[model samples]
Target: MTSGMAEDHRKPPMRDLLADAAFELFEEKGFEQTTVDDIVARAGVGRRSFFRYFPSKEDVVFPDHERCLDDMVAFLKTAADGTDLVEHACEATLLVARMYAERPERSLMRYRHIRDVPALRDHEHIVIRRYEHALAAFLREGFAFRPDGPLHAEIIAAAASAAHNHAVRTWLRNGATTDAVAAARTALASVRAAWGAPPTPAEPDDYVVVITRSRAPLQDVLHHVEHALARIAPADDAE
Candidate 1:
């Protein structure tokens, strides 16, 4: 048992080994040029261990989102009822940004690689959608009584993800500095403010019916509706 304990400490965890190997290979051979076999060969791990940690090559480019998302879900579940859901969602989504901001070089590398590669970009979107879906699901439970609750939840979830992504992209494109994280926080805060506001009334449908006097003629009703619309609609400035 003592020898086994020593052996366990002797080797780096397979997950870390695979990640390090993957990034090193990505940097050396370019993301497109690297293969799973190449990464495993560099890390001295088997193919089985590689799959256990990451589902695809692109997964290696990003942090362990599986765990991060689980953490976010847990964080949300424990949130107090008094906390504004929108603000809490924004803060939770920032965790994703912080995961990247903590490792600037790796984050920048992954960001660039994803931008250059369409497949990786698609994969990244799928991961982001997972976060949005999870957030929406949590919010739906919180707002189950309302008719438009699900839609509102989805809107907030999408907004949260968009804000985080925008900040991370801005940071990567400009320069990966400490200022980047601050930029990310500011951007996330903006989303919380903009989307967190009271939702605007939905646009009217075509051919709306306006109730008036029972004896009112069709022409009078039409005029009433038109006048009401004109009052609400923006004035056209065109000459």
Candidate 2:
């Protein structure tokens, strides 16, 4: 049997090898000029291996998004009770930022290629929308109590997505020199601040204390007080 260390000495995984080969070809020739055959030939793998990992050439440009989207969904699922849902959504976007930051050079190359290619640019938008939809689905459930829950969920999700893209694009444009994760945190923090749940007051300063005669039954008095508070709530909300 081959030892684990010995296995490590072999070529990179088929998926990665295909991606590396495809990117190299994309850089050497234009994205439109690079063929799957060229990529497989460069990687020394079969054409079947390319199809196994990526559906098409466009998919190769975004090899990591599917995994990142799954991770974003899972991360949102782990939110604790009372966690701010908008903030949670914002945090999920950082997962993508970190994915790109993990391999700055490769990310920068992908960014340039996408910018120059109209087809890839359109495909990238679809990929981005998938991430937004995942966030929106999670937020929609959390915000169900609100009357405008669906609308609020979509707006917050879009805001988070836009903030994340801005931070990442800025980082890539500036040569990826700055802290991408930190930039994402800062951008997403702004979204959280704008849309996160408002703090509930510990105690209302304005309250009417009702004193009932001792002769009255306790349960009846409690019910009356609750009814009075319900009546007052609408007026308080208006103010």
Candidate 3:
């Protein structure tokens, strides 16, 4: 009655009941066959509560990503004020990888489920693009004064997204043999190093500098980064 652990009658939270029921249904009856009604019946909940918790059936597969995305954007915004935008953006994207890493078995199951369902695959892309856009938008705001801010911002954001995805896939494919968090960090570090970022520096370090003799195109600055990175041999391949 006190809403403490001793409350044996305390029903399993509706959210968990729904999620557990939905996943079990997906496994038993298959995702396509498991309707919202089926899930609600199993959980002993009603239609309205289901909608309150999730927007769609596919959402049940990865319920925490939306919260993780919100947390990531908050992290980027908090670090944007006179902080290293690139590093922060890179670090922020790790929330996705970490979310999955925190529950490797569930993550793997969801990954396989998504692979089997084309609709979920498409939905996954939308989710990933949102994170990329959020990172880019934050970088754009932070680098507003720079002449080539928008271009650089987009590139860095894309790189961060790619790093997180690559790390997560590697962890899953490797039989989850590596520490997922460490794998995620290493992937991000490789991206940072490729862009001449100091690997896990104690303090922020400037990697790219934008200087133009005239109103040059953004591509010119990007080209300089290409040449600079090409000059140095890469030590890690997002391992």
Candidate 4:
């Protein structure tokens, strides 16, 4: 017999089967009353098989989330040089939004179930934190920010993730017909505006040397000129 067959021929990949079965049972009898054994029986699998794939019945509802997070991290890591970090982060966030949006019905069902359950809501928060941590790591590495660098990058990551989460939750609440991708883009725009634009290149010095008056203090005049230049110069020019 083939290794795959020898290892476990009781059913197909137990995770997927259990997930489908769990969703069906949840839909039929509601999430609160469903049990792990019930899901395994519906999937034609054993209790051991179900436990091997998922720790609890609640987990069957969130299939492939770890894979999705891994994919997002991989996508961000492979971003080309010269791509804006914020833009790259936004794209990564969009990738996640698309993953959920791709299976709108399943996503919506999971969202609804999670909102009504305290344990699921807490688990979802943990997942959200993982994504935020991954994005913040990317930002810190990509920008070469100091360990204690300005909280700007971390703040941006939090805002971006929160925005994406809000968009997805709102879409689910609206029956999942709304364009979540567009809503995500709108949310990311708010994050971008919060972060503002990238740094501009320094301009070449072009100030003319002016001779000073004999009666005026040179220090005072120089200070006044410096302040004026600061106010009048473009950020790039000042840089």
Q: How close to the true structure is residue 10 of candidate 4, measured as C-alpha lDDT? A: 62
lDDT of 2 by residue, 46-108 (tens): 788788779999999888888899999999999999998988889899999999998899899
List model 3 lDDT by residue over 61-108, tens digit each: 777878888998888878735466777888888788778877777777
Give candidate 1's total backbone clashes.
0
Task: Write candidate 1's Cα lDDT for 147-236 as tens digits.
Answer: 999998888788778877888888788777766656767887767777664543576432344679978898988889888766655443
> Model 1, 78: alpha-carbon shift in Å?
1.4
Report the lDDT of model 4 for residue 59. Answer: 69
Clashing pairs in 4: none
Least accurate 10 contiguous residues by lDDT in model 4:
1-10
Measured with C-alpha atoms, the lDDT of residue 126 in candidate 1 is: 93
The digit string of per-residue lDDT tens for model 4 on 8-46 reads 656555566788899889889888889988988898867
TM-score of each: 0.75, 0.79, 0.75, 0.75
Task: Give candidates' CA RMSD values in order.
Answer: 10.4, 9.5, 10.9, 7.1
Best by TM-score: 2
Model 4 misplaced stretches (Cα beyond 4 Å): 1-13, 146-150, 196-239
Q: Which window of ten consecutive residues has the lowest lDDT sum in model 1?
A: 1-10
Off by over 4 Å in 3: 1-12, 80-82, 196-239
User: Candidate 4, 110: how far from true, in Å?
Assistant: 1.1
Q: For model 1, what is the error of residue 3's alpha carbon versus the real structure, in angstroms, after optimal superposition?
A: 17
